[model samples]
Target: MITSLDHLVLTVADIDATIAFYTQALGMTHAPFTVADGSTRHALRFGESKINLHVSGAEFEPKAQNPTAGSADLCFLTDRPLADWQRHLAAHGTRIEEGPVPRSGATGPLISLYVRDPDGNLIEISAPLQP
Candidate 1:
């Protein structure tokens, strides 16, 4: 059985833009690392969690079952409030795809703000509601 999610892969239409959006808007750091095949992969790291970016159309082994850009819908929990995420997105000229609405998180209640990355991937930024 799985204990927790370690990392996830995102097939990106544009790797540079994806890196910029996550690093600049979401406060994540870009960590470029090389695989065993001597190819480099771009990733965004926040603490122990990370999201690896694979350029669409590039050949890579051991990938997602459905590795299509803009196909993933993911939620990220933050200690910062939804308002903060909203502000960051607005400042970066990133449009809110949905809203800062109430939503149910996997472990608890949450308030989430939705946005689309350059690849049009649905990104849900969430803050946990106080118990």
Candidate 2:
């Protein structure tokens, strides 16, 4: 059985812009590592999770059947308050597509805000509802 997600890949249109958005807008850390073919690849790290980046047409082996940008809708849980996140996002000039609306998370109730990354991927940042 699967325990947890080690990492996931995102087929990005532009790696640099994706990195900048995730890093500056979302406050994730950017790390570059060498692949088996000795080429450098980028990843964004947050908590214990990481998202690897691959160019649109230049994906690594064993990739998704249709690795297209803007096709993903990812939700991330945050301990910080939604208000704080909103301010932070505003400071970064990131637009919130939706509000702190109620939603069901993988574990329990959650309030989430939606935003779009540079690649147009729907990014949901949520905080658990303290019922």
User: What lDDT does candidate 1 reach at residue 38?
Assistant: 93
Among all candidates shown, the one with the greatest TM-score: 2
TM-score of each: 0.92, 0.97
For lDDT, the strongest prediction is: 2
Clashing pairs in 1: none
lDDT accuracy of residue 70 in candidate 1: 89
What's the CA RMSD of model 2 in angstroms?
A: 0.8
TM-score of 1: 0.92
Model 1, which residues run further than 4 Å from truth? none
Model 1, range 13-111, lDDT digits (tens) per residue? 888999998888788999999988897878899878899888898837788777899898998889987777788788989888887788999998898
Clashes of 2: 0
> What is residue 15's positional error in candidate 2, in angstroms?
0.8
